[model samples]
Target: MSPSGNQDSAPEGVRLQKVLAAAGVASRRVCEQLIVEGRIRVNGAVVTELGTRIDPESDLVDVDGVAVQLDGTKRYIILNKPRGIVSTMKDEQGRPDLRRYTREWPERLFNVGRLDADTSGLLVLTNDGDLAHVLSHPSFGVTKVYIAKVEGRVSAQTIARLTAGVTLEDGPIAADKARLLSASGEGAGSLVELTLHSGRNRIVRRMMAEVGHPVVELVRRQFGPLHLGTLPVGKARELTKLERGALLTLSRRDAGDDRSAGDELSAGPRSQ
Candidate 1:
């Protein structure tokens, strides 16, 4: 009578195959193959037993020669980017990139959007692919706010033109909101704040230059539900639980509004 108990149930701890799968290493079936091939090791010992259970918290897991942790600690980070550093992971001309700042991070992370090397401000980096996909998609319409210091004084007509639309080499683009922050002075540039949702390359600089007020400096202050705050330049930190929850909610909401039956968010880098 099998002791009159739940005979077909899983035992304590999670299956080794499941742990590997949950870590985004491979599928369950593939993980099983990895286990059978003696590629998986737990606590420095090769594990080949089928249905083997182990505690993820205490046990050290490694796949092949690389250590892997499936603890579901998805990293959501906000970096206060500084000028003269690229936003990408690698650079061809031996220039500084985001990798320089995130060398200590264990998990593989990607930047959500781009900030030009010449610009500075808030930037989001994460390993959560689904949330990144949703946030980066053009359809989500995530808002971005920037403060710009231009070479010369800006005019009401220029603001109106920017509010209306500006013709560029690519096409036409306009700011959702554009307002002056400070007046012009003797050889001092004017300060302006602009808000928009476009991800076009160098859009802000291009628009300002088109109106004869080339951007001397630019800083992104906000993006979607995240803010730059008082974080120092060239520093990175993990997102708080409340911020992560709110961002996840925003991403899910944007995804839910899709009309297509089988549409999936594209996981690609968005420009700012």
Candidate 2:
């Protein structure tokens, strides 16, 4: 269908390939290949044409004889989240939050994981549930990198203790890697970078506090293959094609699919 919402003037629904891709079957290019290969069916009939369109809200879309759900638009966005704004979609106190940044977005979006109101930096907001789950799942071992400013002179002992392990209220936690970004001569306040796979609540803060170098400021530098880059504070943008493709590939790998990259990307829709 055309970008305009005139159903009668143009087509009644979105293209078959777009429908499949938006349904999390695969990327648009791969979804087209699936259609050409006769793997996609609509209302029990094989659809091989790339120009086919159907109302996802009403039409029955099937892949390999199994129906696919096209309930809502799928969006994947990156935000250079600002401090003091909660990572959640909503706040009970009606204070600043992610919703304020995504208020113009049509689809209801949620953060892939929590980032405390006191923290800032790279945060992912998405309506795609499968990718979100795989990205945040601890078993996947996706690394979250952070750059933190701490109060006190950072010592080699501090780095060792952070990397070795520090017991928090929840359990024993350890950084996969930690290094001081500033020289010791910089004095009491120092900048440090940390890498870890844990997603526990307020973990970075707790770990730093326990190590005797309480965090004065914290910012996430990276999440998996994505980075904060030059995105201004409180601004967000849709993930680029390349970034989206790479993330989908990582999610497939995490799900234990051993198919070749090409085949895996052309794979069918996931069940809700």
Candidate 3:
């Protein structure tokens, strides 16, 4: 039997799936399945719950009876993801993943959220599960800023309709902020900046389509306090301390200050 530590070591913490992923066993979704199948043991006892938490260093975790080392350092990476690479840890169709983009890094990491394989720019990767969950959750309202080039002119009426709200097949969708970055003519295509709080699948594309202006190209320039800056496509850089702290504060505010929930919420973008 693996030796156990004081209960103090088991303070409420990151999800079990995230911890397992950071330990380099597999992705979070796979780890959740493993937990459900009773293939994981914490301190020698099988644990099947998805939300179980334990201290990384003090807890003894064994996957399929093999001890797993907990990662000691939190990792945050910013990747200028080029189109074609999937924003996932693994792909069933055998497509290239973000791992290929960060192959040179010593520590393993996972993406904060997914970007469609066809659309890409400024994808964040990290080994910190808490940060990932906080950043990805809709309730957190982390503002995502994107630049889109559409097929035809986006009229002032279309802009008003977008700002007001539009109903999609999925539901009603609205932009927190939108402005014409540049335009050619009333009938010519233009560039626009869209800031949104929701991270729905293909949201930018769908929103533009709803407004009768299908996107010709899309690029995400910012997420929360982080920016793509001048990072070249397919390249990655480590996040600065100030950036991480600001993200943490934003997450805290988003999590609604329920210290027990361990996630925070922030006042996100106000519609303008």
Model 1 TM-score? 0.68
Which portions of model 2 miss their true places by more than 4 Å?
A: 1-72, 184-188, 258-272
Those runs of model 1 whose alpha carbons end farther than 4 Å from true positions after fitting are 1-71, 257-272
> lDDT-based ranking, best first?
2, 1, 3
Residues 1-272, model 2: lDDT tens digits: 12334445644567888888987889999999999899986654567888777767655566654446566567889998898997777789998878878877888899998788889999999988878998898888999999999888889899999999999778899999999898444455888899999988888888999988889899998999888889998899998756765665566557754243244223332211
Model 3 bad stretches (over 4 Å): 1-72, 185-188, 256-272
**Per-residue lDDT of model 1, residues 1-272, tens digit only:** 01112546545567888888887778999999998899976655677876677676655566754556445767888998999989888888889889976777898899998999999999999887767888877677998999999988788888889889999999999999999888677379899899988989999999999998999899999989888888998889887645665675576557653122223213111111
Q: For model 3, what is the error of residue 106's alpha carbon versus the real structure, in angstroms, after optimal superposition?
A: 3.0
Alpha carbon deviation, residue 199, candidate 1 (Å):
0.6
Predicted model with the maximum TM-score: 2
Q: Pick by lDDT: which candidate is best?
A: 2
Writing each residue's lDDT as its tens digit, candidate 3 over 73-126 gives 767789998888888878888998877866777777899887888887889888
Q: How accurate is candidate 1 locally (lDDT)?
A: 0.78
Q: How many backbone clashes does candidate 1 have?
A: 0
